[model samples]
Target chain A: MSAHAHGTQHFDETKRANIKFSAEALTTIENLMKRYPEGKSKSALLPVLHVAQAESEGWLSAEVMDYVAELMGIQSIEVFEVASFYSMYNLRPIGKCQLEVCRTSSCWARGAEDVVDYISKKLNIKEGETTTDGMFTLKTVECLGSCGSAPMLQCGAEYHENLTEAKIDALIDRYRSEGTRKNYTDLNYTNSK
Target chain B: MSRKLLLTHDNVPNLHTIDVYRSKGGYASVEKALKKMTPEEIVEEVKKSGLRGRGGAGFPTGMKWSFLAKPEGVPRYLVCNADESEPGTFKDRYLMERNPHLLIEGMITSSFALGANTSYIYIRGEYFYVSRILETAIAEAYAKGWLGKNILGTGYNLDLYVQVGAGAYICGEETALLESLEGKRGNPRIKPPFPAIAGLYGCPTVVNNVETIAAVVPIVNDGGDEYAKIGIGRSTGTKLISASGNINKPGVYEIEMGVPVEEFIFSDQYCGGIANGKRMKACVPGGSSVPILPDYLVCKTATGEDRLMTYESLSDGGFATGSMLGSGGFIVYDEHQCVVRNTWNFSRFYHHESCGQCSPCREGTGWMERVLHRLEKGMGNMNDIDLLVELAKKIEGNTICPLGDAAAWPVAAAIKHFRHEFEYHVLYPEKVKDSKHGHKEPIMPVKPAPVMA
Candidate 1:
């Protein structure tokens, strides 16, 4: 058996035990964990955070980061450093749907400016600010890795590509409806149509 | 006609298995290098081949390996930079996904040459599935005694580890990756102490791209001199390009380095020309970070020679006319696509991904994203164009790492090639329509809810 050194005892184990990862989320974490060599479970920190962010509705609270730290056997500071470093891992709470608009070169050339404006105006929030109704939060991210489509956004895990003012509005409307109905299908499915 | 090398065994089914790989003469290089050749001889062979780093920079691979600090008793490390995060680049991902054993074989041979006992495959977080595949392959190698402790009974003890990053694009840089591997923030540390001298827990380290390391297997097996004869002068060997967007065949294709761009694009052997028979508007010859080249400039260089896919030919005029083969991400766009909107999206990516370690990149990226946002929305002014260019310039060489440059290059290049489009949007805001059809206008003056009292 491989001897594992669970980094530092940073978070309360009792509190961590109370906070459980969903079966799906745990499975995803386990899948990411398999990517590293034995005893290197710390390598899964980022992917686990991604799943946690999704499960917690687009933001990672302190408790959750700590919980993740405990689960990964890494320092809470290590998790904090990661969360604060990348723009994708949200450190604070966001609106129901986190609107991450790609403002990189390819997307800009394709008309991402209009998409940002439309989203900001529609949500009544500037970039990095959550909406008043808590329905949406607007943020400008780097590349979401879909440069071919260009002018894309990541609303939660789903990427909204080939965006326009009308598409941005429809996306907002769909999110609003999904929020109200609690019958949330994939946003990408709607965008594809 | 045939792939000849580089990707000859790519189409062979079950190539990922050790049995299939060895059947096709895999590990032949390891045997040759360990049994007959000296480490110095292997290095010389690679140097003679004129092989350069396939991961964008085009730095000579042998030169990189030679730079490894051989201080008296310290253990040097070998790291394969599998963090293929550049947009428009999916070649490495496919290479690993399809042929994981190739990478493993390369890693083992390279480790022996470098005198390094330990190696790590630093992969990007999004490559979850590919990483799993690699881990499985590593286990297979260890089982066969090709890895870990006296590999092939050569008395060369080696250990391999795979470290997955937290999805930061900057970590793709060697120094930043070293930091991430050490359980630190993924910010790029200052150089002078390059990873060659101090890296991976402050030890001498050699970091290489997935393809660069994988290419070593063939070089060592065939004798570097034979590999050197494959391509044109100083731009020797083949290159694997990930051709995507508005193309008939959007996948990874490996060809000789000196193949012409026109042939690569229009030839049935390569991309099979643009999709729907659409006219080509522009080409991002490299990855997203490269400058865009209009169709007219895509043909031959000023010397009237065909713009071959070699490093020298593609970057003939630098950013002024051509772009580098950075990571071989060849993205083609049709005339219908608007350049301004495309630039805006790229700006947003940089802004969001900036590690916030420096003032220029952190603030400048955000400002560029905002200005591009207004421009794409048709609320942009004439001065915003210059402002965008100025901001990009500020962030260009001012950041802690090349991430800033990666973020700025596309903006500077977009404005250089398509300033007129930006001006058009400013002059005629009413005529500028969103590319997505049938979408409605967003409500004006969106404001976030005030903090609770």
Candidate 2:
């Protein structure tokens, strides 16, 4: 039921510094582009937008998406079309820590509804609402393929599996104290092993 | 006891690394296919092996490969489908996480067989960390001259890359996957010119599930005939079953086909019997999209034959008393679990995931979810139950892709097998609201409902 950002606004060059990818992110996008054939850099748009969203506070604003379009040599509508289609892409602003709970059949069979309610009551916000202090955002996503460890929630890029009410409290406390921003691109990319 | 083709070395330490993997004969298939076997020979062996797609459709993998429309000078592609978003499935994740090189090796051999100089592993976006694991494994392969140009000095040059897709379940379909690979919305294209004829970038492409591709490693290591002899007829080779939802040992297990459903659930080596020593009520033997089966029907077919894990045995009754071995996502429900609520959950999932390309799926799924929401909330009348069934029947076989049928089967099956539960909510609205979603109460039987005309 949630709506994502559309490319109603034009790209702003002045805000480019705030939306630029890190050096490592830039290299990652460049290498991803090479995976396609010549004149097919548009294939890199999904991964490139992932890098852009990760660089800019964990969600895609209009300007950030436009910049990703420019970087990937695609049009702005191309970026918006992709960013809105997938549930993983957060179009609007989100809190510092986004808690996406798996609310599909297997997880629901093993008490996923209770987990959603517990997190909602604990965080004092609804399923799609952010907290007052911008510390947390609650969302119910489809399957994340961790059904073996059912009743799970994914925070940032990490999956907290076989979750319970007690685990939710501990995770919330950990994230609140850490007080740092997280994004999908926060992977340990340099791990050779 | 069945043989472990896929998970034979799942417990090995550092199996994810290239050195440990190579030490354990990981790339032997790649070497055998590249240096010794011709492309036609490898394809012939696969055809002889009888490996099927592990991504729920159960189509023959060899047949899929032979359909490649190889026009001269246009580069072919071999894309791995790692978008394991099916609700009860996570075996591909387990395989990719524990043994990344197995998949990489499988892709290399497959690419060589198809003469696809390029390959991509299109993984789901939520598995970003697993994507990193795959990326590291790919880098190791490139360094060892296993993936990039001139692989293993056999004149078979292939390049493999990992592409991540954002969260769309419909992208698991082959054409939809190709569309997603081209960085578009995950909408499926109409077939007839299948992905083999006009796939990614309008070239010939072969898309396979991660497990289906990984099986190539064993199919090539052992002879194709030897691989074909592992399981029952047609359903050859081993399968990765991801057991979840109220099962005692809810994890990924590799089993040769022909194992009985009863032994699979109760055997100590597998699911360790149902969780909490509870009585098994029902199961979706495949992923959530498959029709569900009651406990009595799950172990035996309508004709009293013991239901084996093979595809033919699983679908013995043709959605009346049997289900499919689709994607091998085994979800067991104990007596405490409620079918109506679980069906509602799945309906909500399908509603959320419909790509809005087809009218029946786009509207019917939303309608089913809304009607089921009312039924689960105890505010529905008898008409709502009939409406749910009507919507499911109308939605089935009315879309460009099988997602329409996938969305419809669960709802139709739930009504067919658990109509008493739906009627209970309708007749006892007050009691339904009093009991929460997790409240465990036996479903009381009522008079048989009239079958749809």
Candidate 3:
């Protein structure tokens, strides 16, 4: 894993300079900071990461993580470690629509496997592997605390549950067709919604 | 209908003040512990009570406290592992949010027992509201002279702080939590010098679960021997089981240890049986990390004893037959649920949360997830079953932390208990169509590209 980091060119300082947290992100960080007493802005690391990841197109970059570290007045490595350590904060670029499939035990017994298999085959990529077209990335995640609806997957933020091959196929077809229509119309379709 | 122990009076009239808690005999334990008992006596009481770590591992809490290296003149630390990241587990969140003072009282008592002057509560990142609740409660405790220097004029000074983790499941591991607390990466450090000996800035530290710490208050208040008498041998005391999924009552239910699984699941006193009259299929008795127990094995074990929710009884048949009560995440599955798809979903979670710290975990989790993904998508072959097992084995014990084991146990258990599901996907590919979102194409072909070197 360290080797992958070695060959990749280090992020340029100019790229780092242009990375600015949006107003919403800054406000969320400030609110989280108030949760702690004075002189403990570092306590906001996780909330800051959450806001940053949300603002930076659903994933985090090394430069953005470093910038968060600077904003929180902690070591850059501290922020990097957190971003890389968690499965939620994506370090690299992800597909336009990220599929978070809950593969925990309850979901597993509820036919989440079929949903995953259906999604992967439909998208033409295995888990953790994004499609060449960059439309979707197939990834499996742990329980998203929604065990009541087993066999569930979270696309962007909305959860689609009781998933079967047919249900998954239709959902994907709708998203794909919607993407194509938006492309032709030049309408900005926010995938998260 | 009885008064709630933790969150009983969240809706009670005028119940949020320190005076209300005191009126209900809340700080009586703190006053008694401070005025009467010595720190050693408190630790001995806990030891006598048979209180175990409520944080899934079931380590003896008193034994853990004893493990602290006591080299004279060296400072020791106490850290409450509030980083409750276990899947299907949310009891700690409720405890912090509704009954924050219970945890604060417990922390103070536990800290006094450990002879620590400073402590921290490492809460999960997503529990933003709970963190604020704890902070306010801490301020309240400080105002009452229970947390700050010379608490209640006991001369034992202590300071407590709340630290938030960056939402990594691995940080729930004690050592990784310590590392995160120190403003470092949340990776588990190799153990030898366990956290008890050298933790949290290289001092003797005791990292305990929130429930474990909170239990201390009750134990110390009621006297350890009295508390020990409540439950069966070794597993004495009550445990908070977060029952969810296909249950008539889905919430944190506190029951005395050694309650039979049949009672816990089917009894009106507990989970109130499977929801909507669905037949029980399987159960992840513990959190998502433990193996799944099929309906046949969910009953009494070969010991001719009904499976109880206690740590020992739950582990009776090991992973081969019985599941653990780990973190007490009781997730029940109805027969309508597909085992293959459920396992696939769990595999995806492990793969995503692998942290890429070790080769086997990083690569193996990804591999198992992909194979399971294919099987779910109806693109699996018979060989893929063997490959998934092999990949899980590779990741099982080959990582820096137990996160690898956490990821592999579910996969291995799923395949063990539900092999036919994998076979079903392979045999009837047409039945498992594409995801509802897109064209029906194979996600992973019958064969996948070899993991990148």
Candidate number of the best TM-score? 2
Q: What is each candidate's DockQ, to 2 decimals?
A: 0.16, 0.62, 0.18
Docking class of 1: incorrect
**Per-residue lDDT of model 2, residues B121-235, tens digit only:** 9999999989999999998998989977677777778878888888899999989999999999999999879889999999999999999999999999897999999889999
Order of models, best TM-score first: 2, 1, 3
TM-score-wise, the better of 1 and 2 is 2
Q: What are the chain A TM-scores for all the models, listed individually?
A: 0.76, 0.86, 0.80
Interface RMSD of 3: 9.2
lDDT of 3 by residue, B84-131 (tens): 878878788767766777788888888888888878889875454566
> DockQ order of candidates, best first?
2, 3, 1
Q: lDDT by residue for model 1 over B1-453, one digit each (tens)? A: 634565778889999888898899887878887778888888888787788998888899999999999998888889999888777776787788788888888888888889888788888755555666787778788888888787767788887766656567888788888777765678888997888999877789999999889889888888788888888888888888887777776678888888999999999898899878777777888887787777766777744679999888888988877788888888887766667767776777677667788999999999998999898889999999999889888889898788888889888877777777787778878766665411232111112234577
Q: Rank candidates, lDDT, best first.
A: 2, 1, 3
Recovered native contacts in candidate 1, as a fraction? 0.24
CAPRI verdict on model 3?
Answer: incorrect
lDDT tens string, model 1, A55-169? 6655676778887887778888888987877656666666777787876545554567678888788767898777667777777766545555667887644667777777877
Off by over 4 Å in 3: A1-78, A87-141, A144-193, B1-17, B434-453
Worst 10 residues of 2 chain B by lDDT: B441-450
